[model samples]
Target: MNFLNVDIPVKNVPELDKGFVPLGLFFKNYQKGAAKPLCIAVERSGGQIGTYETKIYGTPEMEQADAYYVDRLVKFLLWSWGGFKVSICGDDNVAAAIRAAYSEGGSRAFDKGFMEQVYETEFIVESLPYDKKPEAVQRAESIGRHLDGGRIGFDAGGSDRKVSAVLDGEPIYSEEVVWFPKTISNPDYHFEGIMAALSTAAAKILEKGGHVDAIGVSSAGVYIDNKCMVASLFLKVGKDEFDKKVKNIYTRAAEQLSSQLGYHIPVVVANDGDVSALAGAMGLGENGIMGIAMGTSEAVGYVDTEGNICGWLNELAFAPVDGQPDAMEDEWSGDIGCGVKYFSQDGVIKLAPRAGIELTGASPAEKLKEVQALMAADDARAKAVYESIGVYLGHTLGLYAMFYDIRHVQMMGRVMSGKGGDIIMETASRVMDEEYPDVAFRPEAPDEKTRRVGQSAAAASLPELK
Candidate 1:
């Protein structure tokens, strides 16, 4: 049984005149003691192909020791296709480990930055038990569309829910309502809260004589085929009830709202992080953008050059960014040195008391707010928390570059509010310029109105309503 088999389509092949090449890697599981050699198949988009294989002499664990085989595979791909942009499809753990190796850099086979040139790579993992290929979906056309009448868009965050009435890509009315999805066990509470918010937004638009045309939603967690697979919002709901009812809660709510309104309005749902990236692209009018929302946890999304959302898990919160032996552990996932520990509100709150700045609030969010308020007053301890975050961002940007074709990074969320955000961005910029000058991209935080309204507007653009 070959461990790897890849096939590249002909249309993606780059011509000699083109500046870069596109490559694909299909990585299968590593069998413990299989005698079958590891194999890689490469072909021109024109159908010409050849097989490359190497024998494995040890257990799968031994083969993965120090990521030896992973390093060889990456080098082989780069050698086979020079200056190529690669997409990897494989097991989640293996892909995570390999990607971490590229940035964490402890391999002896290559120099520390040997893989820097081929940094714009993406990893797609099989989501299901029997999935043979990575997930890819054709994105809806044109994130910006003119709705002659009106549309309702909702962005559900961990702490609050934002609803807006949008027309012609501009939001006319918007409101943010606080809700406790994480702590509330009853799904009915969440359902009722969402419907109430949407109802309020829709009524405002209708009062202005503009009929509702469609509905769009942006939410946290893994959404596959418009169904919530794993989400923190449903954490309190039992597995049996969640799987049976809460999984497709968005669609159900949309249907109920449409029936109540006495019209069939099309509803489209997307990941909140993806919506954030779309919003950033719309705000900046640029492509190849990545959006990071450092709020309750680190949420991430990316938009490719063609402005299409890649349908992979872009859940960078759990993705490892630090490879040091003594990295900090994420209390939720128990994973060491993930993006969550460095780029989240929790990260700030965690460091606040440690920095000797006493927090007056009970919850993490409140504690973070207290620290931010202190930073506004030029408190040294609070300032240090943000400065450390800046350093973290600067170093992690280099690691993120290895996976994303990042040209513009838009930073948002509660953690990036007010004076604290400025400190973080300024320090991060200095770090990038001084330490990793080779990295060409810079991080920017959009204005408050743009960050808030633009996200809901982007949510409005998720569906293709004919």
Candidate 2:
């Protein structure tokens, strides 16, 4: 299929979605001939900057095509390597397009508002000079994996909370408790639950003649320096309450616990996606690992080659993968063929009908279960859905490789739970081998029984002791 008057080549097509065209492969061929150079850079918190140099079709007649290509690229780069202020060096028309699209009431309005909340600044896009293009400055910290003395590890989930007490890199006690953080508007419920979980874990450690030294949290959201920036866990919490009680909830909880314990317990909270990558890196005993968790939506984290978590926004859910205007649109982003639709439960549900499986009127989670159950029974339709996902992933990884220096990729979350998971892995590996053989890095999956060591040991290792 053509991408707005541009021909896109495809070596592998998803079993269910024939219109799938990976951005990575498209870029490789898109910049072939008569393309003009374009430089784009984005500046985020702490003056961190990410820059990309791309080429667009150069002609008055192809201005629309240039805008289309640049718009998607800027959006992808913004979500992949986040920034609130964007600088474009090249064509004015495309730069104006980027500015308008990321502004109020534009196509990326949700992204703009979210980034503004995350960075606490107005989102801006302007023109830049080619020779004066800013260099990339990333914030990558070697956090986590402390595993010394008494440590508390907490993973806050929408449906449940998990806590673990680790001593010298070994978990002494761990438990998962069910709760609803997303449905309840009362931040008190969340606060109480968080406190109870922390207290329970601390008690477990104290019973073993240990005390809390450092606490690390892994939760669904964006966090900077252990402060909650933006998250779905507080979706129902009122704006005023969230600003007053929730932004620093993790830090506040630790302070209260410190008062009761009669000693300061350092706490560090990282996005769950980053913690997942930390888990994968620690599991593989290597760096440059990207962890992709496919649950209700796609959550991604990256560990650079130096074994540090890059502070760039890895919220790849909104990032494009399919490059098809007609592909499935994300419910939240209203963008077509993004990663959230291709990599999450939405991807599974989208393919079921095409595979001749009817999951009418079922909850999304229940629909995933129905398909997984069918997979267990060796249903061909279910296999088709997974194979399609596999195809999507293999090429998508090719796109991911363009941005990340990935050495290993850890796939986790509920979507990767059943035999279908195996099919996805095998099929994706095959596609990667055939289509992206020269590309660096290989995808690896941890065992199903104990994938990434329950994330406790990893989260427990976040903060360094003084």
Which structure among the candidates has the greatest TM-score?
A: 2
**Model 2 lDDT, full chain set:** 0.86
**lDDT by residue for model 1 over 266-350, one digit each (tens)?**
8877788888988888777788888999998898888877787655457677655544345667766444656787789877976
Clashes of 2: 4
Error of 2 at 207 (Å): 1.0
TM-score of 2: 0.97
lDDT of 2 by residue, 18-100 (tens): 87778877777777754577889999999899888888876877777677778878888988887899999877777788888
Looking at candidate 2, the ten consecutive residues that score lowest on lDDT are 447-456
Clashes of each: 1, 4
C-alpha RMSD (angstroms) for model 2: 1.5
